[model samples]
Target: MFKIGYRTVKTAVGAAAALFLAQALDLQFYSSAGILVILCVQNTKRKSLKVSLHRLGACLLSIVFSFVVFETIGYHALAIGLLILLFIPTAVMLRMEEGIVTSSVIVMHIYSLKTVTWPIVWNEVCILIIGIGIALLVNLYMPSVERELKRYQQLVEEYFKLLLHEMAVYLRSRESDWDGKEMIEAHELLHQAKALAFQKLENQFTREDDYYYRYFTMRIRQFEILERVMPLVASLSWTYEQSEMVAKFIESVGAAVRPESTGLISLQYLHELREQFRVMPLPTTREEFETRAMLLQLLSEMEQYLIIKSEFKGKHTYIQSV
Candidate 1:
């Protein structure tokens, strides 16, 4: 089965409309308007506006330069050749280089007519208006992705919970046969969530940043810490009392993981866990000492994890985890 993309469909419709309106108004070189539509349509509304403005500037430059040169030098091969040579640098200087290709069509249209007149210039201006105007209109009707973003947020939290649970299980039972697929899945989910958040951010024309954008960024940073924990868990060879204690703390963190979770409570609980680790009997054997050291490292990683969430929520004044 073949599927057409939404932007593809919009571009097709916009181009067809530009062509139809240009012909209906009896504009000369009406096909150029359609070509402009195809060239100006962009992936995002902001991009479309930018390309349209650049093309408009380039088209105007081409007309002015072509009129002056072709009129004085006579409409001949040399004049057309000379126009190309001079106009390209002029367009680049004006930062309308992206529109150079599209505007060249208008130059050819002027040369083919063998005379630069008011009506000819007006015709090209009309074409530019019709094409760019239609493209802008098409861009105005962006579909909402709020629901999809919410769904992604929910999925990310679910994967995070699963990841914490896996970590807890590994810490509790040193020899468990758990493959680290959940970590990979959580990483993949965060990647997708970040992409979606970026798209959502681009869809809006706002000066202020969206909360979801910040939320996803914080999650992405925490996800890196999560990835680091996996190797540390895999390297452990001994099961100690400290390991289970840390495992229970990780389970508490897993229980509290959510998009709305500030994790401050877990941070406090981590402090308590550290105190418990402190006043307990010291390790006698080298193996026990190594286990305690590993547990301490894991605790540091977990503190970093909670701190990231705290900072994000702190900035926005929103408490997500308790």
Candidate 2:
């Protein structure tokens, strides 16, 4: 299968548009406008705009250096080299290194003309404007990633459900043969989801606080808690009565995992479970004591997980259960 990406399409169209417009306007070194378009088009709008500004600034600076150095040192090959030697450090110091390559083209155009005239300067300016302007226009058509973000959200929730349900199963039977591959899957899923969420954030101009990004951050925190809980669950050599109780609670929590879940109900249930454990009979043997102690720690970790989700709900008040 073969496919063309959105950025590729934008670059091709933008470059063609710049070249046609520059030729129509009769600008010298008109092809340079197309090169600028190719260089300016970026993955994100913010990045494209940033790079455009850098290129524009660097080109203007190069024109100034070329006028001064070429006029003073004579319009020769060595003058061009000398201009670059000075321009590189100044561009780096101004944080416009991204524009260095694009600006070099402008320098070459001035060198070919072998003169520092107002018309030549204006010609290069028009070229920069046409190329960078077309790029900015093309970049403004960023496709929405809301659907993809939602898909990742559903995937992360599914992974959480599977992990929690399996942990419950382990606590109940203690004799099952279950490989913990879902843990690794869930970790990787969260990593990818977070990256996508951040990309979504970058795509926006005014919305500084992206909901999905924060959502993934909360999930990552809960996943960390799960990582800690996994060892405790696996270390249970013998299941006690307390283990069954915790298993049932985990099942309930897993059942409630969703985007709209506040985890308030589950948090209240956990509080009651802790109280119930406090009134239970003391462990009869050393092994029972250790197992019961691990169960208590597991309960604490689950509480942290639910608490994280509840905190997320506080920030997003529209998330309500049906």
Candidate 3:
């Protein structure tokens, strides 16, 4: 069985309503209203508003120009062609090119009526109102996506926890057979969540910054830091004694990562880890030296990771406090 989308159903109902309203009002060339409805319904409310304005402007331009040309040259195919030649350039100049096709319908109505009188103009005006109005009404109530965004937020946090915990496990046991596929999966999830957040931003209709969009963007940045940390983790050998402290800290970071939890405690823990790394005995062998260097780099990257989340949380705190 085939199923129709809600937007499709709304479009059909809106078109029917415009046609019925036009006929009931005894408007001339009533079919134009239905055509206008078909032309005006857009995927987003923002696009619908912009397209409706352009079409309305173009229709008005067409009606006025058709009046001047048909009154002077008489209604004929030649007159319609001449009017279009002039009208296209004018519409382009006015940046109402989107309305060109819809306006042509209005011009044809005038030509068929064979007059440029006020009554004819009024008929086209009514058509524009019914069509654009019904479309605006149809698109007014967008479904809320706050719940979906919350779901995405939780999934992202879960993946962060798992990824960090996996890194901790790897640091502690350098020869784990973990495939690291979760990093790729987490990246894909972030990409999809960001897209959904942007769509939600568009649906908001208000000029306010979206918390979900900002949150997803922060996660994207943190994910980049995590990617950098993985290579450092993979390069080092299993030094259970040396990696013990840092591995525990990484596990703590994974546990602390939450939407409400600021990275303050984790960052403080990171500073202590840095001090501990500094006070350790110097490496005696080349391999030991390289491992120490890799471990230090890992610490730097982890500090940056916690800092990214910390700064994001700080900004939100500042805003809420203000």
Candidate 4:
């Protein structure tokens, strides 16, 4: 249970590599390169690259600031304090706030030397390059999260199937005692699936969109519609012939829930179902009218759900076979 994560291993190896390279090159304060590696490594490629850029920029800025401020005022404790006071605001203004802590280390190294010289400056530059470079190098090999993403996708589909089946059961028999736990479980599963999908999106460098992320987004939208349909189904005390038809349709939709389903066939069937409902005799009793109206609303929500799936599949045709 105390196993190390991939990112943790990356950080450990990167830090050690930075220290080793800096020591081999005889850079001053070689341990600082290890610290830089620790600070730069991140869980995602995009995040790690972004942080490395920010730290690189901030460290360079700190060196320039130190060169100017130390030469002008004198390298004293007060000068170091002044340097940070000026450096922090500049980093924030430039949107490099992530590098503030790492850059501070560079500022101290320059301050400890008590003078600004090209040799000292070159030494700090080497340390910066070695540290950040090693971090970036190690982070280049991000283990594929596709397997985990697929696992979440399977879980979400199963929950959707179960939830739809339960809804159909309730609609068909208004007297059943279903506890409605699947709705909550589906909601939580979609939430986690979306988060994982987004992580997968962030892991890729060139991909602007992820199939799993969009898939989860579409499911979340449909889940919201399902939540609306549930109360309407539960409120029906008297089941009519229309309710039975809708229940069967819901069962079919449940059966269709899978990655390969485009929902186009379901959408066509739903349109036919709507046409059939149009020719049915108008409700006579006040209760019958309300129940029929609610059934109509439920059918409308179901149509929206199918449309969402159809549109999603249309945009990403590759998922049809996946």
Candidate 5:
């Protein structure tokens, strides 16, 4: 979660060490330096390892990307002009999106600089590994967990902002609820929220840089509970057409006075809807408006479901009125 770029200061220590070796080895230091830059700046520990590897591999195998481009286009003069056009599809074929970017850059530079071969390529790779090793070592020795957690918090905030944004349909609709597009978008957001929730559940992250990570993950059980409840909430949402009869049937009743109907505007409706949820059934009781509010409050305000400490402790705190 740490920006490999932001770790430049920490990574610099590694760079210096790599430079010392590159110079001692009498290798092409500049080429090594560029490789180090890519390894250090463009990758995280393991998340985007593939992208970084692809970049390195692309650079390693760039003769292929470049050779194809130059051999195919070098004589035409049209090849240099349509360089990107020619290389991109090939990059895709290689399953390298960022690799293509790196490859294209390498291709253009190769065309302009006319340089490529193992004499320098292997040295570049070594330099890159050394630079990345520095960063990985720096991080391993003194991880930026606080920074990672801050990223987690930032992502959580983003999730909420997205959740709030997602609420436009639920808030605006009077006759219906979220449609397929909205639901699909909601599902995507939910997936993001779910992934973000894992950050909260995890506990390995630590350090000044990872303080937020520790905190964010500490309360993971709460989010886990929420995840358990989400599928049920989603089940409440039927297809626009599929649930049309159910929607209208519920709509016609005076939700407050009717036993079968929770008034469209009534908290009683929310309570009944929640009570009937199949995922985690709510306590059966004399269906009341207060009970509905309580259920919603539990989910809305509470962060963790471990203990029902107080009425306001959990989902109750953040529950908003319908």
Candidate 6:
């Protein structure tokens, strides 16, 4: 893999330049942030431009709403706290993550100010703008947009890996994995990426004649289905078959480790038997041959699915939303 060097320098430069202008204009933190935010947006050429613009608009609206609320109700500690709390649902309802983050930060700056220092407001806004602009510009220059775009594939792979880990967590939990927030976020990224990818494909391949272009569209839909279903099943814990195998595999593994006991049946038979029975049905007894096979068959599917998903390329990945 090619190492990226000095990409930060470009981003830093962009941020610095933008921040200075925002301060000079004496713009409120919201307006300044809006400009910088527009710059920070990950540029997928035209598609990224839209996202950045949309986020800027959303953030601006949120800031206005918060400002009006505070002005009308007075920014008491309780009021400010309530504003922030109320803003949370508003942000989600708006489908505006960046807006929420920016709006909340802006409210903080305003509430923190004993006096609304124009200079401080402008500086803060400029800094945010500059940071984003620098990052976006730097992203465009050194990373090679092609390499960055290949990240769509990484999203696919991540979804699968997270699915496996999430499943493992769920298997250990009765209801749901309490610590699954990060995994859920990772899965969300997959959907966001898919949405962005769809927009990019539409813009770049408007003609619909390109093969890879068409496949990319298909990939997004497939990813949507998997993301929705994987989380639902994450907490199912061990399937019926895997639970059955847990007991049998324990004894076999035990006998293998100690050689004092009969390792009855050939190793090849054990392999064939496990695969054949992994999915048939849960066995009543781990010692019973029929039951052992069913457990092995299911575990084998789980193991195989995990292995294939590590790379994020498989029939499962391409599956349409169920």
Q: Is candidate 1 or candidate 5 better by lDDT?
A: 1
Better of 1 and 2 by TM-score: 2
- lDDT-better candidate, 1 vs 2: 2
Root-mean-square deviation per candidate: 3.2, 2.7, 3.0, 2.2, 14.2, 14.6
Q: Could you tell me which 10 consecutive residues in candidate 6 have the lowest summed lDDT? A: 254-263
Which 10-residue window in model 2 sums to the lowest lDDT? 313-322
lDDT of 1 at 293: 90
Best by TM-score: 4
lDDT tens digits, residues 233-307, model 1? 778888888888888998888888777688899999999999999999999999889888988998999999999
Give the candidate number with the greatest lDDT: 2
Output the TM-score of candidate 5.
Answer: 0.42
For residues 1-322, write the lDDT of model 5, one tens digit per residue. Answer: 8555545665576667767767777765444554454454433444334555666665556656566667654634576667666556656687766555555455555566465566645655565566555545554443334455445455554443333333322322322343435334434544454454443333234222332323334334434554454343343422332133223322322122211221234333334544554344444544333434433543343223323211222122223321
* Cα TM-score of candidate 2: 0.92
lDDT, model 6, position 196: 51
Candidate 4 residues lying further than 4 Å off, grouped into runs, are 314-322
> Candidate 4 versus the native: TM-score?
0.95
The models' CA-based lDDT, in order, is 0.86, 0.91, 0.86, 0.89, 0.45, 0.49
Better of 2 and 5 by TM-score: 2
**lDDT: the better of candidates 3 and 4:** 4
Per-residue lDDT of 1-322 in model 6, one digit per residue for the tens? 9665443455456555665666566655534543453445453434444455545555556556556666677767876777867777776777766556656666666766634445654555455555455445544543333444457555545554454444444433435535656555655665665565454454442433232333344444544544454444442433454543343443343233211212233243346555655456555654545434434443444333323223333233334422
Error of 6 at 117 (Å): 12
Instruction: Compare candidates 2 and 4 on TM-score and give the better one.
Output: 4
For model 2 the local lDDT of residue 297 reads 90
Could you give me the TM-score of model 6 versus the true structure? Answer: 0.39
Model 2 lDDT, residue 301, Cα: 94
